[model samples]
Target: MNASDSPRPSALDWLVEAARVRDAEGLHRTLAPRRADDGVLNLASNDYLGLSTDPRVIAGAIEAVQTWGAGATASRLVTGTTALHAALERELAEFLGTASALVFSSGYLANVGVITALMGRGDLIVSDGGAHASLIDGCRLSRARVVVVDRGDHEAVRTALRERTEDRAMVVTDSVYSIDGAVAPVAELYAAAREHGALIVVDEAHALGVRGRGGRGVVDELGLSGAVDLIVTAVLSKSFGSQGGLVAGPTTLRDHLVDRARSFIFDTGLAPAAVGAARAALGVLRAEPDLCDRVRENARRLATACGAETPSAAVVSLIIGEPAAALEVARRCLADGVAVGCFRPPSVPPGTSRIRLTVRADLGAKELDRVAAVVTRARTAVAATDAVRR
Candidate 1:
């Protein structure tokens, strides 16, 4: 073979150059093993209601393992689904006040299913500019013409809907923006969707167990309930302290998804332990509705101490602006026996890198003070670093 015919290095070598660029920009990521017994206070997790380790939640999971074995052992369409799954779906739908609900192995899959099943060629999708990665990917999978509007901009959403030539359209968004922790304008979006005759699909992954009456969700808080034509999706891993995803919508939608949604049709059923845990969590949420207020209160405490206004939910974003500054702040907090989420692009927009603190309802007054102080110190350190650099 001629020298020119030989491959120029290899595609694998390109990864090394990419890594160097990421390292230079402070955009590289590494996974650190979490030591449960370590004395680090956690503000990085999505366990908003602090039920993940609750005695009842643990017991429910254990009992399910005994009853249904370990793994699902098959797909839901086969023999994977158990009575536990059915019960959880029914209870979740009823508790959320929806016509019906369907379960998925992960919230990500549920999102993909929603888009793939509902919108194909000749359909349209209006998405939020800052929607979660899952929703973004889901839209990409659809054959629909997708339009992204500014975050929570109902006018833009409506404009896109108005301009669509397709008769069937779906408006997709996250009820709560994960990075900034800002709640979406669900009511306004609903109105636009209704006016445009578009179906609404909202991923309540961050809202389901943290908003509304007993964490019923933003739709319930807005009293959309059965009155609005909508679809809601959530992850059980977060607020529910379990692992799985669900879709709550009309009975017909559930039926269609069951047959047409590739993710749901092929993926293994959600594990029995997750089903049981979510069921118990839902019951606990209903009985102890005050947990919702507690989480919000904790978030406000952290936000106020960070010099930011009170946040509506458990997440409080302390924007660092620069990627290096955000990483430095996160490292400082971790060194001080606290763990906080460090968000950088492409998770968030460039120049908006920040530490995202997710407050737990169980955090005591003293714990909250400690978290506040640590965050303040990290932020101050970032300021000092900038001053010295300048």
Candidate 2:
């Protein structure tokens, strides 16, 4: 057929087809913003300390806006760097016991920056199989030879490192696995990396405000302060109850990142309000280190109540083993005025559908009891549905 005679699919056609595929698999995703006064109990968010709505944090953001304006007008390389950013960096480095720190717009960008900047085409990157999506993306973007070891396998990491033919090697892992809420064997992995002359990068997203002294993170908790070659990233939106991310390492490494990391050089700097709120949150953490104990206690309590019936950690994931059932349970919890997370195929490994509930320090006894009741009810409903299907 002639070029003019041939039918061409419109640009929107692909989107429609994609939506249809998602609908068929019940995998379609949608965003529903929560109202400021929503009465629903939240067990889905990553705000472990529940400081997102704290008066101090809000006041800090307000003060920052008044002093430094709303948005960063340009990238950090241009006009985005402010006194607040510098202060946050300094305070963060001191808190984490790192030699230097570089703030990024988000945790995802921080990972992208670290991995790609440090490892090039000839280098090798050995990562945990269960590392966060951001780290996986960073490895792909780095153009490095990426090898994913078994989840929490220190020996596999060592083997991978030993087998590496590249001149430079790096090992990456999360201190806490986001989905299962299981902690990684960071000390063993670090030792293995050291033995092989490979640098270690730990993402302490979930461990930052939940582990270590004054929530200094897993590195501090393990007494590996300033020992690991590099610690890549964390989301301020989580425990900090703000926005932005950070990379902490040696002064020379950070200086190299500032010059080479594309994500830091090209992206806009963190907004003043986020920096201020994070700073305030860090100050609060320093003052009330007991917040860490409360969060840990809440998690342990939930895990104990669930017993061997549910998966562990601050994140108590109830496996349904079926996507539709998991979704239904999540819906039931929501209808009962408790919001919990539903993880299916793409998010979880295939066939590991689960309802992931994250515990927070702000969850009072009454709220915890309510959540327990709702989850039990949801579980009963799923069991009944399964029985009927059989």
Candidate 3:
């Protein structure tokens, strides 16, 4: 028989089935690119500080491109490390009050690199159930025995640590949950890990530009910055308005990661433009500490508009319960010239699909009022439709 006529399954059949399943479950996703002047009131992006289009940030990127070109030409171990990278690292460490810092091309790489380098086979990893996907992926890749405790369950974390059979263990969590914007019990978790001789890794992706003093992040806010057992992974993309990630901790840890973290050794360094942009954003954060306060206040107002609890950070989540309903609400808001995040299964758990709203420091009161009106109308319309269907 000819190969094309054989009855064997095509290699792509599984992917087609997967797509069908996603569509059936209302989980199919597609990219929606925004035009430069879409005029949409964007409350969906993670630009908490609103520095992405700041003049200083733009100039920094331009300067970097002019000086270092468009990309980090090679892997860091070869020739990608530039002066901008070094300066950004030093400044990040200083801002976070850590001894040293290591930069990666992305936050996912930073989390995976640090976790896999620190914990290996036979080691234990106690992770928060709601930790970011990067942290979860890192735990899976570590080849360590993993225990996922309920979010904010400090007691469970302690129990896992106490019951651990592995000699070396690490506890992982996000400082601010990406879905509901809940702040982790960082201090309690830190104490538990310290008492149990376990290292703690905190991903501060959402907390950096919105929480803590001058946006130093939750670890610094909680006074755990230089704790010997603490390590921090942060994304520059969200808070810094750039494209990169960092691992900040002890100099010893930095040294070890440089030697042992495969992601660092093999991945190209962050482009000079990102490094410069992040640095400029950091400077803006420091210069205008009020940006932190402004963002949280804006988030509080947004949450109040939707009747959600006030957020500890810049994200305000309104649970919509069903993926289709959540998508419908988001669609209605977009149609009204407001953009919002519609988070469904996998991004959130079943029955907790939600409209996730992020606030920027520069969001004006008038814009927020409009957002409140649009979101309220959307929710009301969806509910009315649901009631009729029922």
Candidate 4:
């Protein structure tokens, strides 16, 4: 081997360096899969309505699998469009009060498709600083000039909208932030966008089955259904307990995305089983509206017991400051037979490491008490470790 080849580092060396940095900073994360037979108290999952394991939902999935087999088999533009896909789109549109709706394989793909298809070079996108990473990546792909405004600053959004040079502009934000569970001022934001002739896009990933009357999401909650200009996108993975995404909007916009959105046009359509499961979940939501309230109450109880502020939605994150401490707290809770989420930098905004907890309608009072006790012990342990270091 040549001397240069022996001394020089490979491209994979950069990955090793990154891993080393993460290890030193306590930012490294790994997945620990739970066995199907293992029984543990779960406050970590996004199944807010607890529909993933519901009998009706499972039955629907089974039926679909029996009829349609496994995969969609092709892209929707080609041979993948099925009757189930059409039915799900129609039902979602009717439920959300939109003129039309289109489904994507995942929420991430839906965001990428919408942003890239609607906006282009010379277009302007005014996004909230707290918008999810998918939205941020979509902006990058759109080749639009992205102006990130302060979180929930309506007046600042208005000013930016008014000052935009591009004839095409869009305002994007989440209805409920996934990390802190804070509700966005959607009514004010949409009004500002309308005044400036800009389209508004709201991602209701966390709000779909957790907000509004009958869980129709923020638009329905605010009674701004057809009045909002552009569209709404959401994940089926959360409260819907399925694996897909959908964009609800005017028929013209839906058609535009169908034709131009690379994510939709190129990617395989959602599985038939997922479509069926989501439809079943929607039916369940219609029959039992109080499930939403129960999830909200569970969230309130946990936050109250922890002496933390009650989250505005189903996600209640206890901000633990430092990353190492947050991880330690999560570990202790796991050891205590409680499974909770630990979110650190990159997943959350810088300096806001937290143990993010999602409340489920299925969690009873006894379960809540156990969770509270474990969290209390975890918090005390973290505090004592910090005191020792000082």
TM-score of each: 0.97, 0.96, 0.98, 0.98
| lDDT for 26 (candidate 3) | 87
Clashes of each: 0, 0, 0, 0
Candidate 1, which segments miss by more than 4 Å at Cα? 1-8
Q: lDDT by residue for model 1 over 13-101, one digit each (tens)?
A: 88998999999999999989988799999999999999999999889999999999998989999998899999999998898888899
Q: Residues 1-390, candidate 2, lDDT per residue (tens digit)?
A: 899998987878889889998877768778989986888999999998998988999899999999999987899989999999999999898999999899999999999899999998999999898899999999999999999988999999999989889989999999989997888998999999999999988998888888889888888888998885757467798888999888998999889999999999999889999999999999888999988878878877776665533333367877878787888899999999999999988888878898888889888887887888898898898889899989
Which of candidates 1 and 2 reaches a greater TM-score? 1
Tens-digit lDDT track of model 4 for 1-390: 878768766768789889999988889989798977677888899999999999999898988889998989999998889999999999999989898999999999999899999999999999987798899899999999999999888798999989888998999999998888999999999998999999989999999989898888887899977665858999999898889989998999899998899999999989999999999999999899988888889999999988889888898889898899899999999998989999999887667899988899889999998999999999998999899999
Report the number of the highest-lDDT candidate: 3
lDDT of each: 0.90, 0.87, 0.93, 0.91
Q: Residue 364's C-alpha lDDT in candidate 1? A: 96
Sorted on lDDT, best first, the list reads: 3, 4, 1, 2
Q: Give per-residue CA lDDT, model 3, range 1-390, as digits (tens).
A: 898988987888899989999998889999988998999989999999999999999899999999999999998888999999999999999999999999999999999999999999999999998899999999999999999999989999999999988899999999999988889999999999999999999999999988888888898898888888999999999878899889999999999999999889989889999998998999999899889999999999888887889899999899988999999999999999999999998888898899988889998999999999999999999999999999
Clashes of 1: 0
Global Cα lDDT for candidate 4: 0.91
